[model samples]
Target chain A: MYYRSQYPRDLFAELDRLQREMQEAFDFSPSIRGLARGSFPAINVGGTPSSVDIYAFAPGLDPASIDVQLEKGTLTVAGERKAAEVPEKSTVHINERFGGAFRRVITLPDDVDSESIDAKYRDGLLHIAIQRKQEAQPRRIAIK
Target chain B: MNMNESTQVAKAAEAARNEAAMLPPVDVIEDTGGITLYADLPGVPKDKLSLQVEAGTLTIEGEVALDVPQGMEATHAEVSLPRYRRVFTLSKELDTQKVNAEFNQGLLKLRIPKAEHAKPRRIEVKLT
Candidate 1:
C-alpha cells in the first residue's frame, strides 16, 4: 500500500516522496514532527503486558463511516471524510484539512490476540485495543 | 469499565502538562457574509477545548486526552504530545462580538461575520 505508481503522478505525490526521503535520512522526533503530506491520518501504536492500544487521529468523520478490520495480526483502518462545502463566489485562503478516503494498515506484535479486539471512535479519534494471549503475558518469577 | 474515570483524568492532565504544543491543520474560507475557519483537532473533547478572542486576535487551544491502560508500556509510538495551540490575527472589519463556533467529531468551525460598516451597501439615487 505504501508503494507509489510507476506512471505519471501529481506534483503533491512527488513532494511527498521527497518528504519521505528526508524523514528517512533525519528521523525527526514525533514530538516536533513536520507534516506528512502523503499520510491522511496519523496513528500511534503501543502495547502493555495485557493488551495493545492503537490510535488513529482523523477528524471530521462520521463514526458509522469508518471500517476497522483485523486479520492474521494485521489491523486496517479505513474511512472517508466528506469535503466541506464551498459556497459560490467564496474565496478560499488556506485548505490544509484532509478530505477524502484514507486507509492505514499496521501489523501487530506476535503477543497480541487477534480475536480479542475492541474499536471505538470518538472526539475525532479512533481507538483500538487488543488483548494479549495468556501465554504471551509477562509474569514475575519467584527466586526460591 | 476496567479503568476508573478519575485516574484517566489525572493521566490526561499529566500528559497535557508534559507535552509540547503542536499546530493543527486548518482551512480558512471567506465569503461576503463572513469568514469560516475549520480546524482539525482529534482526541480533544468539548470540555477540554477553548476559543478566545482578545484585542483583534483569536486563539484556538485544546488538550488531547489519551487513555492508557493501568500499567501499559509503549512498545511503539508516533506522537505522545497532548497539546494543540494556534493563534491568528483577527481582521478589524470582522465582527468578533458575533462570532459563532461549533465543534463536532473533533472538528471546530468558526464563523466571524463581517462588521456592519464593512459590508457592502447600496445607495439610493436622488431625483431632483
Candidate 2:
C-alpha cells in the first residue's frame, strides 16, 4: 500500500510539485538541528546500560493534551496550552507568560529500539524511556 | 497525580496572589552544562533586579512593584505575581564568571555560556 495522489495528465507533474512544496512547509523540523521557534520545552536526557531516559519540562500544560511517539529513531512531542482566563475587573500591569500551542520534535541516537519506548507524565514533566536492543548494548571484549 | 495536586496548588496559588502585592515567578531549565531561566516581571523596571552568577549558583532576587496600580483593586485574584525569586545550581562545565543576562519584551533571557569542551562535536569516521 502507498499514499500518492494521481492527477490529470496535464496537471500530473505540476500537482506533484505543489504537494512537495506543501510538505516542505508543513514538515515540523526543517532545520538540520531540528529546533523550532516559540517556547521550546526544556528536556533532560539520561541513559542507563539498557535504556535511555528523556524528560520534557512543561508547566501549566494538561497531561491529556500531550502526545508522545517514537518512530524511526525520532522522539516527537506535540501539545497545546490554552490561555488562562483573567477577570475583566482585574487591571493588568505585566503580562509576560505566553499561552497557546507548542510542539517539539527531537532526533534520537540510532541505538534506541523504537517499538520498546515507554512514557509517563508527572509534575509538568514528560518522562520517556527507550530500551536498547540486545545487539545495541555495550559489551566488553577480552584481548587475545 | 500531578493534575490533582495542581488543583490544590491552584487554591494555594490563588491565596498567594491575594497575599502578595506582586508575584515575580521565574521558570528555570538546566542541562548538564548550565542553566537557563525565564522570569516574569510584569511591572519591574530595568534597575530593579541585579543578575549575578557567583561560584556555581545563580541568584535572581528582585523587587517587583513598589506600589499597586493606580486604579485597580484585587478581587478574586489568581495571578500571584510576587517578588521574583529563582535559584539555579550551575554545573562545573559552565563559566560562571562570563554569564550574561538581558531583559527585553517582558522576558528575561539569560545566556550562561558553556565551556568549550562541554559542547557536542562530531567525530570523523575513518576506514583503515
Interface RMSD of each: 6.9, 23.6
DockQ of each: 0.35, 0.02
Per-residue error for B103 in candidate 2, Å, reads: 27
Question: Please, what is the TM-score per model?
Answer: 0.77, 0.41
lDDT of 1 by residue, B50-92 (tens): 9999999998989888877887777654444577877899889
Off by more than 4 A, model 1: A1-38, A140-144, B1-19, B122-128
| Model 2 chain A weakest 10-residue run by lDDT | A1-10
lDDT of 2 by residue, B1-128 (tens): 69989899899967743442333345455554454555544334567765667777776655543232233333211223335555567778887766778764235667576787886578999999
lDDT of 2 by residue, A23-65 (tens): 7557653457532322435455666767777656555556677
The CAPRI quality class of candidate 2 comes to incorrect
Candidate 1 similarity to native, TM-score: 0.77
True contacts kept of each: 0.75, 0.01
Per-residue lDDT, model 2, residue A59, is 50
